[model samples]
Target: MKITSVIARQLLDTKTRPLVEVEIRTDTGHVGLGAAPTGSSVGVHEAFVLRDGNPAEYDGLSVHHAVASVTDHIAPALVGAELDLRVLDQKMIDLDGTSDKSKLGSNAIYSTSIALLRASAAAAGVPTYTYVADLMGLPPVSTVPVPSFNMINGGRYGDLTQPFNEFLVMPYKAESIEQAVEKSVKVFKVLDQLLTEKIGHKPQVASSYGYAAPSADPREVLQILAEAVDRAGCSDIMAFALDCASSEMYDKTAHTYELNGRRVSSAELIDYTRQLSEEFPLVFVEDLLDEDDWDGYTQAVAEIPKTIILGDDLIVTNRERLERAVELSAVDGFILKPNQVGTISEALDCYSYGQDRGLLAIPSGRSGGVIDDVVMDLSVGLGVPFQKNGAPRSGERIEKLNFLLRVADSVPHCSMADVSALVKA
Candidate 1:
């Protein structure tokens, strides 16, 4: 098949956030779909390098210069040149020791790679996951319980206007869906109380940006959450997971991170989580510190009870960094994001590695987009066993929830009827 054209679109997710979608068309009528950066000020233009009838091919290549080089210098060589899309991988060795995955920007490289992979898969008559598994010689994927996060119940932090958001704790399992709903309700109630105690008001849910405000102190916040869990209607809520995306505030650089106009560092933050874990237990804590502070992360995890210390931005979906974190004993879990790493295959590779090392895998969605269905599918197809999406509300959050609900209906016993199953593992 010959490469015929490459097209892209930048869709606004919110006033502050936008996501790039790209399509790679082939002469044989197969089109590969992927996402890159979005927005003019961001690296959107430099993300995709096209060689069709357009002169703006190099506009945004700075964000993904290496990938642009591949498309500009290498892809054309193979476009009308005729190579089997299946079984056709340009390894460093095969590229005459030239191409390297390390040379490309994280998002740019991932998007481009997956676009090529998907186009190839479509041309070869197989699902992208199946093609990937065949290439890796892996067994069929197993179905795992979907994980739902309860960030709606947390004290407010940061500027109320900022679009950024964070998930407070992950509850992995529940004996029944009703129990999960009840637990969620309590968490929100506790979150409200925590915010009222510290900031003097209920945290407002922003409609324009879609993030909760008051990014309050993690300590008091988790304590309130722990109390809510203790008082909630489910005896079986214990089996659910605990999310700690708030763990990263410790460093002096990002220390005193804003929450409801309050400044907090990692030291002041983690104790509440530790106390909660000791009292109620938890499944995982993601982004406990700025990515560079591996020592602090390791120390905190060791000190924090039996819960898993997960790395999201800290790990960044790179194998080398993840391996380094493992060697340093910095994490017990990984929050996988395809866009963060840039491709479906790379994310899966990281997930498999996490699984092999006995680390918990939590597939997460961007808090900023409606284009998250593919991520949900990839998480299930990869057998992550647990997924972390947003609250039961919000358009982006609801998008993921709807997909999981449909999946649950399709598979009877394997449904997300309980959140506790995710917690135990």
Candidate 2:
């Protein structure tokens, strides 16, 4: 497909935050729409999320610069270009020529890159995942990723009194994607009911992941998840995952984390994460330490060998950063956020790198997402061992989850990544 024109629009994501979406039109008359969802707890190494105009306006967050990059620069740069995914994406990166995509915002570049992927796949008349798999030189395996269900949210997502950001119900033993989602939903409901009975009312606040409850205790969350899984009659089938988002809590200057008013030292936090991993059915943990705390992650990952130590902020979806983490043995896997690196191809490279190092590659869509199903295809295309999706309630979250279900049905030999050994390890 020959690229024709590119356009950018400033839209609001599910969290009512400024987001940039790109629409790419090709000579084939196919239009591809792509979205980049911003997160409140972003990593320092992540590509600059730029804002323009007055600081007082819209919290000093605007997409005018990003929009201009797409329409004015990006659009002209590739108007008559052939949509070889790698070439097209690299053109944008080259145009910027910076490590963190400071010239054209990562949001602008990624949104456009994603839209190009979709448009090219559409012109080829194949499933988006299949096209991506071809680009990655991987066999088209219909592997349903292990369900890393983010069933509870804390920190930037909502109710930051709780130090832990995500309470995940991992359906490690589920036989299929359908069964996995079922187990997740049952546990979520059971937990909701338990919260209602223990507290005054059910957690009616719907977060990006799951029901947001006002609690700051990780032990309490662990206990509640166990009870909920047992009550749902799936104790053996489901385990827990924690996305601590510790960078959100870590005070860089003080070098101590504040948890519910207590100043927690790095050693204390690592000890606590290890404690929770051992005491609970925690199969996976992400960002348990500050992003820059290399020693802290090394210690935590060493102690929690059985649990999959995943890195989000620690790696920031960059292969160069992933190499540093590997050298330190700081993490076992990565939460691949494409926008963090400004290209799906780069994100795939990180995924491939993780695979060569015997690391888990988890393609993740941020919580405050959109209705676009690009993440759904990206997860399937990468053939990740796991894909982190949000809770069952939010309509925005359901769109991707439902699309996964449909993808599973479309592919003949769809198989889910079984985390049974990791959970029991």
Candidate 3:
């Protein structure tokens, strides 16, 4: 089928959510819908074209806009040309047409590619995952694990720094959910104290409805989480993980420091990490070191217990960088975010690479916007044990949750994995 026209829309759900919706129509009248919601980067939509008379200027292009512009520009060229989307995506990346090497790009191209894949799958009368697995020579899967949720601490708190909204979550146990939230209040209060002591103002702290643990004082944090899990009514937490994006930041001498435990220092950062994982039921730690501290990251990974050390910012999504990370043994898990890399195929490649290394390849959505339900399909199709979307509240977070629920209901033998159990296992 040849392309007929492409229409796009910019929708804002609230101050925290902004999405670019694109509809591609074929000459054969087959219509496919795709979108990339950039919650943190709203300017990307403006950099793209409107259905009006004149298109917007290129100067308006953000990373997201650059992504969408590819669809606006390249979709027409491929029209009437019999081509496979996988190959087309490869060509786009090969030509660096939307690589965003300059760091000014969008995930719009990724959305466009997903739209084409959706259209191709519909035309073939197969599931999206089947098509991807068939093309990539990966096993097809029916079920995947869900993130316990980071937005809602048993519906007790919200993200205080960025947007203000409540999160919905399935608590650890009805009782622990309350306790965990109560602990969160204390933890954030402590964090606020630390921040106030350092930055002269309390850093607004957000609580995850279900998943509540910060990078500071991992042993104590895990205990608090375990208590929350028990209070929530789960048999056991199964596993504990740490989101350590600030790992490198704490050790930097130039940056301001605080008293995490007798004053946070470089040695203290690594020491605390090791202590927490060894003392508590820690399973994974993401971005343990700064993105650039490969040497420190390698050393830290080696010294820590055999927990899954994951990388998001550190590995970014470039194949070369990923290959380097693997060579250095920098991590044990990979967090796959399409926007981080900018294409589904690229993300899949990262997932596959991690899988080959016996590492968990997790595909994640974003903190904002609910585009289409392609990510849910991709995770199951690829057999990822865990996924990192957001809390089970609001449109951006609920889109993935609803997609999984619908899929589980329709597809027999498919259901949300006991996320906690899967993590520990």
Candidate 4:
């Protein structure tokens, strides 16, 4: 099968922000759809997203330029191309002729890349996950990732005054994806009730649908989360994770981080993180230091040896950055966001590189996500140890969870990825 046509348009994400959506049609009458998500706390080195600068349009956040890039540049090049995803992606990358995908927005290129993947999968008459696994040169496997459900929100994505961005609960002990999701839902309900009782009403939810915590203190927030897990009878199976997104709090001029209204140096911040891990069941801490602070990350990996020191903004799903991090021993794991690198093939390469070094790769969802559930298939297909979607609320978030549940039911003998060794005592 070969590509017959390509189309692009603008759509609103869950947060009502404009995003690019692409559609590809094959000669065999298979139609595939794709969309790129927007992130609220984007990394400095991630691929660029082009937007129209008209102040009157979506408050200057409209993606009309991206849409035009697809119709004017990408579609014309890809219309008669073969249905191979890598070749199509390379054509778009070469057409852009920029390191960061500035000429043709990452948003545009990524949507098109994903659409091609879906179309090819349809043409091959296979499930998306199976096709993706074949593309990765992996044999068939029925391993689903342990879900990292964000239970509380803070920092830029939340209305709370806390400095941390996300507080997550990972149900690693669950034998199946369905069981893991059930455990998360139970804990989420208990946490909601606890928060509602304490705040004297239904608590407000954050941008990612996690509850907006009432306190600014990270320790206090973790305590409440622990209490909820205990109440749900899931303390034995549940582990906690934090996404500090600390770069948002870092001041380049002073070379210090401001957390909970106090400016602290890198050493001080590491000590604070260590204290949290000691006090709570924190198995993972993401972006605990600034993106540029490789020395601080090395120190964190040394001091917090038990917990997984993961990187998001620090690596941006780029292979070169991941290579440097591996050389410096800066992180134990890395988060995978396909849009961050602008192409599924590149993201898969980065994941493969990290896996070759025995590093964990957690495919994650963005704050400004869409209804697309491609990440779910990617996580299961790659057999990654963990996947991070927000709390089991809202359509966009629930849609991904639903996909996992469906896969577990449909795939015979499928089992959840065992993550017991990664959990810290």
Candidate 4 clashes between residue pairs 3 or more apart in a chain or in different chains: none
Worst 10 residues of 1 by lDDT: 38-47
Q: What would the TM-scores of all predictions be?
A: 0.70, 0.94, 0.73, 0.97
lDDT of each: 0.53, 0.82, 0.53, 0.89
Show how many residue pairs clash in every candidate, following the order shown: 39, 1, 19, 0
| Per-residue lDDT over 96-210 for candidate 2, one digit per residue giving the tens place of the 0 to 100 score | 8998998888989999988988898888899888888888888886687776777767754344578888888888888898988887888888888888887787675645657
Higher-lDDT candidate of 1 and 4: 4
Report lDDT (Cα) of residue 70, candidate 3. Answer: 51
lDDT score at residue 280, model 2, on the 0-100 scale: 85
| Model 1 misplacement above 4 A | 1-4, 14-16, 37-78, 81-107, 120-144, 153-171, 175-202, 206-215, 223-235, 238-272, 411-413, 416-425
Superposed by TM-score, candidate 4 places the C-alpha of residue 308 at a distance from the truth, in angstroms, of 0.4
Better of 1 and 2 by TM-score: 2
Stretch of 10 with least lDDT, candidate 2: 151-160
Residues 1-425, model 4: lDDT tens digits: 77899999999988999999999998889988999987999999999989898899999999999999999999999988788998989999999999999999999999999999899889889988999888888878687788888999886434546888899999888767887899899999999999998889998888778998778888889999999999999987888999999998899899998776678999998998899998887879999999999999999999986689999999999999999999999999999999899999999999999999999898998888888668877988887878898888999898998888887778888778888877874
Ranking by TM-score: 4, 2, 3, 1
**How high a TM-score does candidate 2 get?**
0.94
Each candidate: RMSD to true structure?
6.5, 2.1, 7.5, 1.6
